[model samples]
Target: MTVHTAPAPAATMFDVRNPGTGDVVGQYPVHGEPEVAAAVERAREAAVWWDGIGFDERRKRLDAFRGVIARRINQLAGVIHEEMGKPHGDAYLEVALVLDHLAWAAKNAGKVLGKRKAHAGPLNANLGATVEHKALGVVGVIGPWNYPVFTPMGSIVYALAAGNTIVFKPSEYTPGVGAWLVDAFSQVVPEHPVMQLVTGDGSTGAALCRAGVDKVAFTGSTATAKRVMATCAETLTPIVAECGGKDALLVDQDADLEAAADAAVWGGIANAGQSCIGVERIYVHTAVHDAFEAMLADRVGALRAGADSGALVGPITMPSQVEIIRRHVADAVASGGRIVAGSGSIDGQVVQPVLLADVPEDAAAVREETFGPTLTLRRVEDMDEAVRLTNASRYHLAASVFSKHHGTAIADRIRSGMVAVNSVFSFAVVASIPFGGVGDSGFGRIHGEEGLREFCYAHSVVRQKFASPLPLMSFGRTAKVEERLGTIIALVHGSK
Candidate 1:
């Protein structure tokens, strides 16, 4: 007779707390390697079915999924506000953007990734070629908490639309929001676990990278991205890392100061300045520096960060971020940076908006990713200096240029991935454009046609239409045939 041993205990559990209040919003398991592996295996099976359904059928399912999210948008928004400390209205707005992107991804995936004929060169006229994008099997989405519903969906929705199943590992700080999203999708497509949620911290994320998923799409701090990259390297797994940014906004002498100031304030302080694309640095032409400063000061001063329902700004979602904000402000002031408006202090997790001026270019607040409700302003001699300073940052993520006549011209000069002319972060809302950055801001894209293709591998097909008299691919070709092929290549390419 054999004795049966008791099963191992379940994984450790953790609590997700509201940043505004110290209250526990929800509790979830810290999924380990075993659970993550299981999720990946399940996703692999689901991906087979998901991808086999063909683009038209997949589009229908995605449309239904989008409808689910739209119908209970408020519910998801509530979860976002509770888990991440964004204002209720702001949370709603974030979900609205997600809905638009989801709809676009669903409607356009077939057109973007469908098989299409590719013209064969004259030398290969006997062959017919076509190109198609095939799903990567399964995708592991490691999401961020700042815009829980919007940011991850950029990868999740597009990957799903491309016919890949997903194993989403949301930020531990906002696991409840992740749960809600998965639940919503299940309501529509309950046949299989097309979208699964694995809740935990960095270990869980690492497990995902190593669990043999087709690809991992991550969004978080640049430092953390490096770690994730290293983990993915262990498995030779590819990843799309959407990291942090110290984005800038440029103001020209001819800009509409009123519009520029309003956009800057919203771009820098909304969501308590947690956005990766948020404007943290501003370079203004000296001609309108004073006027613009005054306008910005008035706007920032009127804004407050609080836990109240009507407050425009909310508390810092991650407690550790408060210290970073505090340090940046203190360092700026110590380096002779003056607070033009609002106080540079932290009351618990609530950091009042601070507009700093005269900070040195090398100051931590200026050079670093100060993910806080603060903006550093500097006056430049001209638009030349404005563009120079804007491109100097190591984080070439995104930027905004404000000029009545030269907005596009100035935007084209910036080294970032995308720029908005006379506006802030507008490129993100447009469904056709890609969203990403160069350098430390991370690689790969998350929106538009590029985004849908990001989750797929190109599949090329070539069919021989007829036997070629001069076949280059056969080993039995005669020397005369090779000489003729060489002559053809020289004729086609040597002149160019």
Candidate 2:
């Protein structure tokens, strides 16, 4: 007898287009709710095997994964450049940053998550305590199109290093890039599906939040984050949202005009200003405002945005963002701001870098996240006013301070989660520094020791070495023991 089952219906499909030319770069499966749920279920099984391997063994596999990425760095960079329309050099730089983070997470995970002894006070001298960060089973990572490699790796790598299995949902615009990453990891650790990919749009991400994953690490706009949070709330699933930011750069009177101008331009316009930490506003002290403005104008005048090989800035990845950029620039000019460089124009998906000066403090260009290659400059009386204006924004993911002498001092006064002094985007490159923000920029970190711990839950164990002379955990304690305990507590802590 021959028995046969009907072939499963073909999965839904979608096309990924290149923003630069609107050409079909690739086609991907549109993974829906059932597919997402199945991936998470598989991840749960993988998580057990991954967790049981222990940190030392996991480190070996992670290091091997890093080696594979390093060997094929240029190939991955090409995919990033093609899908996202970022310059090849910029794509390569972002990939290199990922390698650095991979090495850091692999090298430090054992120490950061490994069991360690905790101090037992004299009141509990008979007890020994140890704590370890255990993996939270499976994690769902929803990534953004911009800086797809670096941004998603910030969550994906850290989660994997912490021993949690991952089910990734890359942005719809960059599914090929995401697929490449997962495929590379498979080549290195072939035994288990420690990392997997599911490709789709916003609804797919919502499906992931409802797919029964232990935690969801999301990187996108603040508005989208709120929606994802709402979906996850249904299952009470914890989330880490790395959302949008209106980051700023503050220039003091004593700042080096050339260095500050260069940093501000690059920080604001690099990656076509799609970075969450990209500087959108600049505050200059009146003492050096004119000099800085002239320097900025001269520098900005030479840059261009195009689809050509030499262009520093490329086409906007999301076509819808081009109109948003237009609206912001129009609003800035209407609010009495002056455009000092490049015509505020959008042709197809290519948006020319627009620099506006004297923009109203309340204008959309200043208050909202444009996520485009636009910079708004405002002159203040001194560094104090600069800091005040910078801190006034609703989003505060990161900022940069440019002052020769008061660099660190000024950085300390900023309310952002991370700040770069004398340089721009420096904190992101340092794997040891935590990356996240408060308020509308969203909460939870994705890098460094805090990042490794983000995908884990603490497990504490206490062992009794001997019986306590006067046990507080027992019901048979007498009044004399209670009096002695009260006296010890008062003597040790009441004086303060």
Candidate 3:
């Protein structure tokens, strides 16, 4: 990893360490209050240059940024691997997915938010009407460490494509990756600080919310998101919060256990199971629970977490996360849940896959988001019961359903904002679909057309083709005009 000389009066003082070795990989400038405030203030000015360039010009710049990302994909991935401790392949995949989102956002921003004519209503028939989406100035983004590139890039690239400058605060755990992204973007648009970085701890993130940015897009835990929202609320800044999810996977009686096991293991244990949309709960049909558990256990037991190619998963990305994983495991075992395989713990940071069965609904393992290399297996009477248990959480981010007959129906009923019917998180990978949740999981959206719109506001325009003798909006309105307006409204909207 490249190390720049530590600057005096460091704006940011974040430490980056390899999760597996506990070795200090790097130290980043933890952008402070004044610096972050300056960045946002600067981005506001940059927003003018970025937005004034127009859509076509912005597309050209975005395409250039894409070339930068593509050219240094592996180099960027190496930084990600060193910072977040994920497998090299996983890191590459994360950046690759982000490349797709960048391309989609730049290509489709115009169509999704362009001006369109609309009915002025019968009351205003004399005037024409249209609405066009406009950029929302400077946007601040707080990102997570897991999928460090893909998740944050979802907001940063889309915001940039929408003609808004971005000041991003990536998770301190992966500040290096965030810094790398902002630096690369600068190469494409070197004239302005259109994309800037704020590196620090939670307080730095709070500083961002308090900054005068137009909107804040935060992706993290529900608890932290609440704090971030409250901070942003002081200024009434609109925010898009993508919080945690204790997502579940339901298996119908006629479903395939082998395929379900494959998805469950991949979704739950991949990235060391740190995914917000990762499968933490599994509700298998009672008749098939045993077979399904056996298959899941066999698959999970074979998998290992290491920095080597022989193992599929890497270590826990955060040191604090290891304890959280251990707590959830111990809690589940103490609550009468049986560990079917791999109890947990390893040399430095590796955590072996664990499968828990008979986990009580009241246990933290079942309700809370463990966000680790663990899975809770349960059996329900039918799909109805499965849906009931799935929607029991305060979070509704993402979910997965495995069923031969009722996958779509079950998925539709679940309250999550996104779902993968026969797969895991396929919705997020598809650049056209929106990814976000409602309720405690937070509001607004990112990715696809929705992601682009979140960074902008609609501007309506109305022009009259020809003036009517009867203008209700003016003081010239008379009894005859009122009667005529009522008649026109009734004719157009009443029985018709």
Ordered from best to worst TM-score, the candidate numbers read 2, 1, 3
Which tens-of-lDDT digit does each residue in 55-121 have in candidate 2? Answer: 8888888889889888999999999999999999999999998888998998899899999999999
List, residue by residue over 1-496, the lDDT tens digit for candidate 3: 2221112265436578988777898887766678788888888887899999888888888889889989999999999999888888888888888877888888999888888889987666688999989999999999999989988888888898999999888898898888788877777788888888877889889888998999999999999888998999999999998989999999998887789899999999999999998999999999898889889989988988887767788998877778888888888899999999876765567888899999899998888888888999998999899999999888898899998888998899999899898789799889988999978878899998989999999899888878886777788789999998788879888896
Worst 10 residues of 3 by lDDT: 1-10
Q: In candidate 1, where is summed lDDT lowest over 10 consecutive residues?
A: 1-10
**How does model 2 score by TM-score?**
0.97
Candidate 3 — which pairs collide?
A: 11-30, 12-29, 12-30, 12-31, 13-30
Clashes per model (N, Cα, C within 3 A): 0, 0, 5
Pairs of residues at least 3 apart in sequence or in different chains that clash in candidate 2: none
For each candidate, the alpha-carbon lDDT, in order, equals 0.91, 0.90, 0.87
Per-prediction TM-score to the true structure, in the order listed = 0.97, 0.97, 0.95
